[model samples]
Target: MYSRLSFSWTASSWAFALLLVFPIIALVYEGLKPAEEIFQHLMATVMWDYILNTVLLILGVCIASLLVAVPAAWLMAMCELPGRKHLQWALMLPLAMPAYVVAYIYTDLLEYAGPLQGALRDVFGWQNSQDYWFPEIRSLGGAIFVITSVLYPYLYLLARTSFLEQSVSLMQSARLLGKTPTQAFWRISLPLARPAIVVGMSLVAMETLADFATVDFFAVNTLTRAVYDTWLGYGSLQAAAKISVMMLFVVVLILSIERYSRRKQKVFQKALTHEDDSRFVLLGWRKWAASLYCWSLVAVGFILPFAILINYARYYFAASWTAEFFQYSVNSLVIATIVALIATAIAVLVGLYRRLDTRPSTVLPSRLSSMGYAVPGTVLAIGVLIPFGWLDVQINDVMQWLGMKGPGLLFSGTMIALIAGYLVRFSAIAVGAVESSINKVSPSLDMVSRTLGQTPVKMVRRVHIPLIRKGCLAAILLVFIESMKELPAALILRPFNFETLATYVYQFVSDEMLEYGALPAIVIVLVGLVPLIFLNRSLEQAH
Candidate 1:
């Protein structure tokens, strides 16, 4: 069962996975320090508001997501209307947009000085904010709407897939039992899709918790905001670490609910071999309504915001077009490219270990490695800083003891920390992608190669790599896009004066000057579209 250096691979895999988790361990270790003074101060001030806002944000997103996603998913999967074909994939376009980008764009449009409210005031012959009532786009409710609009696509994608895969036979049986199409959907389709909905909500919940820029921009206080403010605002890393620990607890609770829901999920197998021609056919007003619903989501979530960014770029071209902008773009690309390669390599190694070695010793590392994807970037950044900062100090101390000039923060003060934080945060994307491809290969092929006197390493090199080349490319592309868009961790861990496209856009956004940053923000959205378009084509082929 052993390949050449199987021991080496197994040992290294475990070590690497452990290294990924060590940051979280470090956070917990640092939280052991006294934080009572900071905690008491926060409790007396904004802590309760943070808790309330965060909970309300999660609940609001969940409700909005369900309302928006379920009907859209049903329409795309089960009904055929005008442009239903295009809307099926168009609904996923929002998946490429960062929620913070959407927030920035919409707030710019809907706020008092923006076109929407200005037009409203002009149409109503109103003079000022005191002259009329308008919904504020910078409140908790606005944060919910902006984030949910962009993020509901997560729910839509999964819920649509679930709807498509539902048992046609069961739906037919419901119809046979004298139920109308609507009743059958309410009774059978929705219940069957519950697990997918739960999974989607869990994704939304985690993303909501991870959000810093969106909430920060809206001036909403959430736990993620509190962590950033406590650390960067108060000059207290200890308090920051404690708050991060608390945030991790929230993640754990989310994951626990996900696990429990998954355990109760019922899987339904397809009983019929062909498509049921009896799909709920829409006509007249219903068809138009369905079309309106699906198109509205696509427009609000992607098309409108994207168009606004383009307009801003056109109008503010001089402000946004400069050498600094080019360098920021290049810096982002270089970092994402590097992190993607490293994360992909780690993913491949750990994935191969799991495939070739069945022992618990080898398997556990892979499982451990996958856990970091769920941890928030803020928590991951703090976790990274605590340990890496300590290690840098030890190295400098050693240099001083040897009568040599001490090097400054080697790992913590440079790109090393940023890349490390990225890998720890995003490697799971690569691991899952590669492992999926590896699993599709037949074990019999491996056995035949082994019978021909090939070592396991050689057999994998010969057989597995060629088969999963597409999957590997897809993994690299995905991780690259994610790294490009990643912000919180990059914000905390980047070297001073270093700027990625995300951080650059964020700077303008924070200063309320997104006009000058519009082009880069558009570049980010366009870059993210690469993988979404690829995945959309892939899903088409699969269907």
Candidate 2:
């Protein structure tokens, strides 16, 4: 009897999960269809440039993010330096700033006509680009810098947790072997945290791969840009779909590596007892130097960019603070809120199924639902358009047959497509969050509820949902933030005449008028702070 009930629940959960997974399947199906002529054209012309640029960007960002994140994470996790507590959360502030917004802000401040180079020319009596050496902010290296500055937090967040969770006994064993604290960290702590670090690196690699605005703004030709240019520029959706398939293969490889790394887990017998009491202490210049280094990352990543935006807002408030801007903000919040609610509901269904059913039917869909998170926004946008566009055409034809006027593009050319894109892109965050919280609730609780004459649905509502409320809230906030900051998908999927803050910012950015959009950009970052603060507080309480 229980088996029959479980089967029904599993089937229903799979159906819901597959609904979330359909867009990805549509993308793959579209990509797999024949496009031999376009494929040959790409192979002969711009394909290698796209491939090479994407590879180089991922490699550069991975190395740079590790360099920035691992050291700072170690400092905050292991060493007790002045301001260490503040720097720990402060380092995470970058996660709130979108890389493209940072790219625009820094480019504005660093370009020749901007304040930095202008002041430099005045001070050094330099005349032009040829006068003295200045690193171009609109180049590949600048994209790496801006992206790494914002993305390093992915690594830092995981690596620091791994470090803090290290068994104290292991560190003491290293010390007993006559190793210094630094040596112990190098040999013992770092090795123990390798899997976590690699997991973070994989995340950074995925983000670097998915990014479009930073690369597109800098005119760096990547696979993401290739998709955009191929579709919108050359008006070849087939070619764009092909490029997206290639990107999907790349994402598959990266996700495989991440999964393999995560599976190489270490079991520590010793558990955390006291937090600050177990940390290493730093003294004098080393203490100050550590603080300076950590603080510098925050300054460059968030503080400086934020300061520039505030300055721009001061002068541009009248121009930016208008009805149109308010509508854009409303559009952003409305779509994001709807997406968050839907994603969270889907997450709860799938998450509970995975926790209770323990069957292949329930498990596979739950896993496959997350595959979209690795897919680049531009790629997902292409993937989403194919089926939604076809569905719209079919619906229109049916309406005409039924003797009613066709509502053209009822799905593809409206917020429905945009919401679909957001759900496909960010539902994984919600699933992961809710799954984690579900895992923490003991199985005995479910058993108790079942023995007390409760259905699985009632068990979830009365027991699981209340327990995982924090995780559900986190998932909602996270999806909301990501939806607000998302640019490429929103740019492609938004209805005619509709604009979100991200799309609005992209317009001014495309016009090389990012300063005009600076205020809205700042608002996006400010809104992002809600989650960052929540995350930091969560981390603090965990410790």
Candidate 3:
């Protein structure tokens, strides 16, 4: 019995092991070629430009997002901001806008022939492109603006928690020193929130570095966009893989730095007491200013995009927006729901493995599970295709040997492949949420339950489940929203004719029909809003 139990545990661990490492093997194997080839590509046609552009995008998005998220999180979390309860979801609306979609919208809105410039031209009677001062939306700055608008929510979410988690006693101490609320936040809250902020910024940086669609849409030629160009345009998968390997090294370095900073600071805090953090009243003009700030964020993130979408949706309605739209929406919801559940399940198993807390045992699986967050969507899709393709081939060969014919059941030519790709991409969301919740579950509770002669599984089910229920729900919603928002991997890996709401929007936008695309595109954002709101509500309750 003991041997069987031990083998079962080991089998479980090794099963997850292959799931984690196989994709990485695919990435490395594809990238490895003669060093001469890699060096030649690096030397010819401006690798430095690619690197520089990528760095600039990361830096610009990081700085701009911080500027927006920190102040917003501070106002909402620390002050008595009016309508804080309702405004939370509104603040997070930009997250639903894929960076590529944002690029398309802004380019159309700001371009010479587009509405904004056309209105200006009608007002001033400007004749040509050079006649009026209009910034090109295809430029680096334009890419930065689109990315920062959508990505700031990452920083906002983390910073909100850090703010809400600020010790009430520390705020009182700061007040006794005669510091104002703003001063206290900068001096006290900001410093304390450093770790969480770093975590958030790391996520933003990694995401910016990994983005392909946004850079591709803007035609800015970052490393990610370059990778795709080499792969598809030049028909050099080897060269693309090499570029990807180099990019992977950079991401690994960033992740390492983040881990080091987090370790050095060790600035994790759980709310031992949920006391209010000395909320200051924003009276009269101050209140108006605060409300205006929130409104402006929502306007840029939500209202402007939505209003335009609504205007164009009238056209779709006139065309009698087909039943196909709802069909695709249902398809998207069904897939998103399944993938989110599976991702959460994988996360639960991974978390449980960690709770076992055996040193060498936990190390590899934990690291592998976190790899999803660091990998680009495109790379992950490629990774999924390689292994699943090879696995299908191998299975067919084995079946042939056995005098039986079989097509690839789990992977090839099915919705399962799409879901597998999604799980590979979005598993990090589940892991982060579940691990945090599990950490807060004290060992003493388990100890007491074990003393009552209940089995460990029963204790976890009856006691642990109830305590960590909020975290599980949050994790599921987070993963669901992320999967719904996911594009590149889904675009690449979906079986023929499989369309999600994201894919529907992408099809129109890809064809340069942003106006016609606006309706379903808005639906994507609205659907995403539901999960985002649920996540915020969970986080607030957890605090």
Q: State which candidate has the highest TM-score.
A: 1
- Global lDDT of each model? 0.87, 0.87, 0.77
* TM-score, structure 1 vs. true: 0.96
TM-score of each prediction: 0.96, 0.94, 0.85
Query: Per-residue CA lDDT of candidate 2, range 163-212, in tens?
Result: 88887777667667888768877887888888889989999998899899
Per residue, candidate 3 scores C-alpha lDDT tens digits across 501-533 of 887887777777877777778777776778776
Per-residue error at 408 for model 2, in Å? 1.5
Q: Candidate 2, clashing residue pairs? A: none
Sorting all predicted structures by TM-score, with the top scorer first, yields 1, 2, 3
The reply for model 2, stretches above 4 Å from the true place, is 6-11, 173-178, 261-269, 358-360, 400-404
Tens digits of lDDT, candidate 1, 415-456: 999999998998889988988998898888877887898877
Stretch of 10 with least lDDT, candidate 2:
1-10
Candidates 1 and 3 compared: the better one by lDDT is: 1
Clashes of each: 0, 0, 0
- Minimum summed lDDT over a 10-residue window in model 1 is located at 271-280
